[model samples]
Target: MVYKMSVYYRATMCITLMLLLLNLCEKGYGVNLRDMQVPCEEVYMVKEGETLNSISEKCGDPFIIEENPHINDPDDVFPGLIIKITPFRLYSYKF
Candidate 1:
């Protein structure tokens, strides 16, 4: 009876530990995993002499205008505007 109780206690503790680990694994960097399902985004900082036109041209995609809604005006972008950039991705997977 004592051996059976010990085995049962160990099993319960192991299951609890596994569940705790799984819960911790779900939260990553405070970013919602669902938001990233729409697009794979990159962070880019505005630099001197860099305009929205220039950045889009460099990226070879005018879609930056659509992706970056914070930029009210492409021409009106100023230095230090943190814009969201989506690069062409070959594949994506969940962590």
Candidate 2:
């Protein structure tokens, strides 16, 4: 009778430990993930010699204008030329 009781108690302890571990696994590290979805917006032209970096600092993320690499030579932008700052992909996931 004593041996049966001991075996039963050990089984109960193992089951309890398994349940606690399962509970901890279910409540994983709580981190809220977010998708950075910013929309495109327009920005007015600045005076000559202004740079994209400077404009980004003043305007903010998802910067006011999307510069076209094809036409917008970083070294040669003219004043009064409007530019479209379109939404561009910023991140990717691989698995």
Candidate 3:
């Protein structure tokens, strides 16, 4: 009788925990990529008053210097300067 009761209790606990986890997941507890506005362009032209860091954040590309080898200097960016943009979010699955 005791053995049967213990098994029943364990099964009930497992089911309860699974329900709690499902509830948390439904409440938006993880990354929802659908809500993000990721840029689709592979090439981008720098606009006036925009720095590399600002462009990185705006375009979602974190490795602007590595992608664009022509940028001899990070601070030499100017309006009409074309640069390659590959968003970091696209390769996030590798990690």
Error of 2 at 47 (Å): 2.0
Task: Report the C-alpha lDDT of model 2 over 32-74, residue by residue, as the tens digit.
Answer: 1233344334545656777666655544544443345445455
Between candidates 1 and 2, the one scoring higher on TM-score is: 1
lDDT of 1: 0.72
Candidate closer to the true structure by TM-score (higher is better), 2 or 3: 3
* Candidate-wise lDDT, in order: 0.72, 0.57, 0.81
Model 1 misplaced stretches (Cα beyond 4 Å): 1-41, 89-95
Q: Pick the candidate with the highest TM-score.
A: 3
| Best-matching candidate per lDDT | 3
| TM-scores vs. true structure, each candidate | 0.46, 0.33, 0.52
Ranking by TM-score: 3, 1, 2
C-alpha RMSD between model 3 and the true structure: 7.1
What's the best-to-worst order under lDDT? Answer: 3, 1, 2
- Please report the TM-score between candidate 3 and the true structure: 0.52
Q: Give every collision pair in model 1.
A: none
Q: Cα lDDT for residue 95, model 1?
A: 57
